[model samples]
Target: MKSLNHRTKVVILTAVMFVLLVAVYACGILISEEAVTGSFLNAKRPPCLEHPFGTDALGRDLFLRTLKGLSVSITVGLVASLISAVIAVLVGIAAANGSKWVDALINWIIDLVMSVPHTILIILISFALGRGLKGLLMGIAATHWCSLARLIRGEVLQLRSQQYVAVSRKLGKSSGWILTNHLLPHLVPQFFVGLILMFPHAILHEASISFLGFGLPPEQPAIGIILSESMRYLSTGMWWIAVLPGLTLVLIVLLIDKFGDHLRMILDPYSAQE
Candidate 1:
């Protein structure tokens, strides 16, 4: 009965996660038409039945704009996290299987990258790349891989010492063959968890950079941009302008992070057994 309960819980969590992901991805499509058009006459309206999340200074529907921004953020997070995950997997494999000198060099690189503050490094990278969507994506993809790489490297190193792996080495299998056939399969769980874990970080960083005016342009209705724009109206009692969007962003990030945790729990053999 306990086992059945566990399975049911896992299934429910999986369904919830799937629905959340689909909703996030489809937010742009669902809200794009309304978000693109605004009316000055309806401007600065408070949250009500007609404008559930209120209207911006330009009379744009805050709810639609928020949804659109979240959709963009989710897209950026998905792409950046996938890129970071791939880079981590490749670097991790190289670090684990390469010569001692190569391993040392990769380890040093990882340490150097991780030693710096992520926000500072990301800002510098984004600035250097000219501060737009491209720069933001690059900054996020480049900075978020070190921890995942280290995790993968450690996992691969441990897998390499296993009896089955040793037997494969003795069977005249090439290094590439052993990696593809043995190491890669074993690293799937770590890779997936790491990838999902990176998503919230990517989204938050993207919003931060945009808020600081170093990410997506002002024309883009990103959460950061929304919050930044809302600053001018705060003294006039337009609190919902900032509060609603900011809370929504936080809620999305929390959901993604929780999803990652749940996924990790479901995928971990020990956790499943427990």
Candidate 2:
């Protein structure tokens, strides 16, 4: 039967992504420093059958490094987005269920976070945290959770207004039990949608921060760092290394973001119709 749920189709796309990322990551690990360093005196070769994506100034294989970049971007996006989603769910539920002051405080902090320019705020936070992987992860995660918090808060609010919630209150159900049984189920769809939406932001933020030199180090196989390295080589006519990887990164981000939209459609058919 033709399915209305879209699970099979979505699962296919997810599997494709999972396979692509894992393959690239495995390639990154097995690639020797010798291959990337181009000790064979073949640095800066243009794209050809032997060096499909071309070679960088240092003689590194662009295809390998590009895959490495993809791996790093995917890893960063996953880590930061997951952390943000968890924090958002916890904080949003707290605000939704807590007393007046608690709700106000949560909203107020969310507001404060939203007021700043996100990339700049991330940089400042990363700088303050000593500007490494930890700093970059913390910065990306910290800058990107308000929308998730709002989503969770709205879900919780809807749950609170439901008839079952009132009955639970009258039936001597503890707040914890009510939250676990009734509210948590409703929260899942919202959480999933919020997670997909957060992913692109996480990736773009990581790339931008790294481009500015506050994120992943230059020697690492990060997209932003690759692009940064290409800037110096561009005038000399070796543009494929940076440009191709960058285009690949953009395509990957767009694919994931569109996939997220598809997921939201799956979870909220009414929203899709609208």
Candidate number achieving the greatest lDDT relative to the actual structure: 1
| Steric clashes per prediction | 0, 0
Candidate 1: residue 244 lDDT (0-100): 95
Extract clashing residue pairs from model 2.
Answer: none
lDDT at position 10, candidate 1 = 72
TM-score attained by model 1: 0.96
Residue by residue across 1-274, what tens digits does model 2's lDDT show? 2664456576567667656656766776677666666644878889999888988877888888887777788889889998999899999999998999999999999999999999999999999999978999999899789988987998899889989899999999999999899988888888888887898889889988998899998788888898888889999888897778888888878877877876776677565443
User: What lDDT tens digits, residue by residue, belong to model 1 across residues 1-274?
Assistant: 3556775687687778879878776876577565557899999999999988899899999988888899889988899999999999999999988999999999999999999998889899999999999999999999999999999999999999899989988989998998889999989999999999999999999999999899999988788899999999999999999999999999989988988888888888887655
Angstrom error of the Cα, residue 251, model 2: value is 0.6
Best by TM-score: 1
Error of 2 at 243 (Å): 0.9
Which runs in model 1 stand beyond 4 Å of their true positions? Answer: 1-4
TM-score of each: 0.96, 0.90
Backbone-clash count (model 2): 0
Task: Evaluate model 1: give its lDDT.
Answer: 0.90
